[model samples]
Target: MIAAKNVSLQYPDGTVALKNINLSVKPGELVYITGPSGSGKTSLLKLLMAMEFPTTGTLEIMGRSYGKGQTGPIRQLRRMLGPVFQDFKLIKGRTALENIMLGMRFLDIPASEMKKNATEALARVGLKKKANTPVENLSWGECQRISIARVLARKPLLILADEPTGNLDRENALNILELLVGCKDEQTAVLITTHATHLIPANQNRIIRLKEGVMEEAEA
Candidate 1:
């Protein structure tokens, strides 16, 4: 569902974040982008998500090409993807239920239907008990779950998670991974970027490792 060819990214200061990366991810596949710090793992994800444009080469989402300052095409591409950040970008004052509902704000779903879907999503993340709690009052793990629940509510064609389990304990991290994997289906592609090797599944065949801005097959 996504492809990047000879993609390179450089900052205003001329620091190269990604270098000639070529990669493709298909629907229903769960892939991990693993690499060390400064290896451009996040940069690759940002390009795929259309948050950043590559300074060189091409990035294709679904079928459209994305280039610098092309907000119309980028926004159109993003509507089909759901992103979960490592920082758990939840509104502090909003309740978990509200946070999840925010994902469908662009849709014309009624308030009641939105609430129902949000509640079900929270239940899926084991956050039903904390549905009414403010995000600022939640623990780090709970906030993370809320982030996933928000993505689930969107039902995007592709899911992009960046260090999704970074701040959680072992059990919590496992639960988050399970939720993420469960979200995949024939129409959804899931791509995750993480530094923790243990976070990877043993039977996964789609893992791609990034090193010094290059892509390679992740060893089992």
Candidate 2:
């Protein structure tokens, strides 16, 4: 669950990345954020991730509010989130399974359960064959799916994905989107930022469009 009320993000250089953004995301909801380059899509995700605090307004993620430079609370809040970064962020020389397991090392999960979750997540992404394969040897799309597997393995309440399909073909992109959408449940929500609007299927899911740092709901 996420709530942003008139949130605005401005850098120290006076660059305004987001303006008066209002958003609400609920559990089991799958929302797509579509916009062009420098349109504040990534900036909004950063705010939700607590990588940056709002210069104005308020943001509550999972019932926790973010403040300026609240490192302790920020760390605690982030632990409840599953983030899929644009860059694979997989450790080089590590196998796919290891990369997935590495994401949960700090959590309270037992070693065996961690391995089981990692293995299951990889299989769910259709990459069980690559379990032992070094991530550096995998293709771009594979790396992306591995990144997703890393997130799914964590089982966080909120999933924040930044351009998970940015570098794939149409088929792969659709598959990736489907994989992410399938992660939602009554206790989980999925929010994805992508520029490719054509790949989005017809559904009742929410779509927020950002243009020139302004946010608006896309027409149904």
Clashes of 2: 0
For all predicted structures, in order, the TM-scores are 0.94, 0.97
Reference-based TM-score, model 1: 0.94
Error of 2 at 44 (Å): 0.6
| Residue pairs in clash, model 2 | none
How many Å off is the CA of 113 in candidate 2? 0.3
The 0-to-1 C-alpha lDDT of every candidate, in the order given, reads: 0.86, 0.91
Highest-scoring model, lDDT: 2
Which candidate number has the best TM-score?
Answer: 2
RMSD of each: 1.6, 1.2
lDDT of 2 by residue, 86-194 (tens): 9978999999999999999998889889999999999999999999999999999999999999989999999999998898999999999999999999989999999
Off by over 4 Å in 1: 108-112, 218-220
lDDT of 1 by residue, 21-44 (tens): 888878898888888877888888
